[model samples]
Target: MKIAVIDAQGAGLGKTVIKKIRKEIGLNIHITALGTNPTATSNMLKAGANHGLTGENSICNFCNTNSLDSIIGPIGIICSGGIKGEITSSISQSVFNLNCTKYIIPMQKHGIYIPGTINLKIKNIIEEIVSDIKKNIEKLS
Candidate 1:
């Protein structure tokens, strides 16, 4: 399946997700890393993304008007001036408005106070996404 993994900044999370998927599913999957910066895209590329694109314009061109099979990322990717504020509003709108299946990683946006950590349950969120992907692929096949 063609999967688009969108991240505004720091592809560490994307890298982790890609690694887990590779470990769990041995099939060759198509991964598109959409990042706001080159570093983020490069990291995901190293993690096994088949292709990578950076910047708001590039991402918009890659994803706009196309109902992708799946989009995996945090809600921030759909929001303007958030985590990776560099993600242009147009790109965010395209992703949010497109008629595509989205796998939003769970994030606790409330009642959390950490000095230097996001405190998000990233592993659990990734697991949920992976499980869903497995089920969908199985049903489709």
Candidate 2:
């Protein structure tokens, strides 16, 4: 499966997610780190992303044409000018309009409250995503 993990700003979160994915999911799945900046992308790349891309255009291009099976990132990736208000409108539109399954970590810092996910920790969120991915992959058999 081709999974994209996107992030902006410090990208510490993206790096964390990639590390967890690498340790838990193994290398069978392909992971690409898509960041709003080169530093963000490089951070995730060091965490074990098979590939990396940066900038708004790169994100849009990938979203428009590719075989991405799933997208994993903060919920801000779906909102226009989200993620510290740095994500461009085009990036937001692309991810928001994606047809693939999305694994979003609801963040309180973003000032958007997603119902049914209140006060959950980041580690817990990643665990849930990993669990769901395993189940979904199994069912696809």
Give Cα-based local distance difference scores for all models.
0.77, 0.88
lDDT of 1 by residue, 19-46 (tens): 8888887555678889889998999888
Clashes of 2: 0
Error of 1 at 19 (Å): 1.0
Residue 89 error for model 1, in Å?
A: 0.9
How many backbone clashes does every candidate have?
A: 0, 0
| Candidate 2: worst-modelled 10 consecutive residues by lDDT | 132-141
The top-ranked prediction according to lDDT is 2
Please write out the lDDT profile of model 2 over residues 8-106, one tens digit for every residue. 987988999989988988998899899999999999999999999999999999988877778999988888878888788899888877788888889
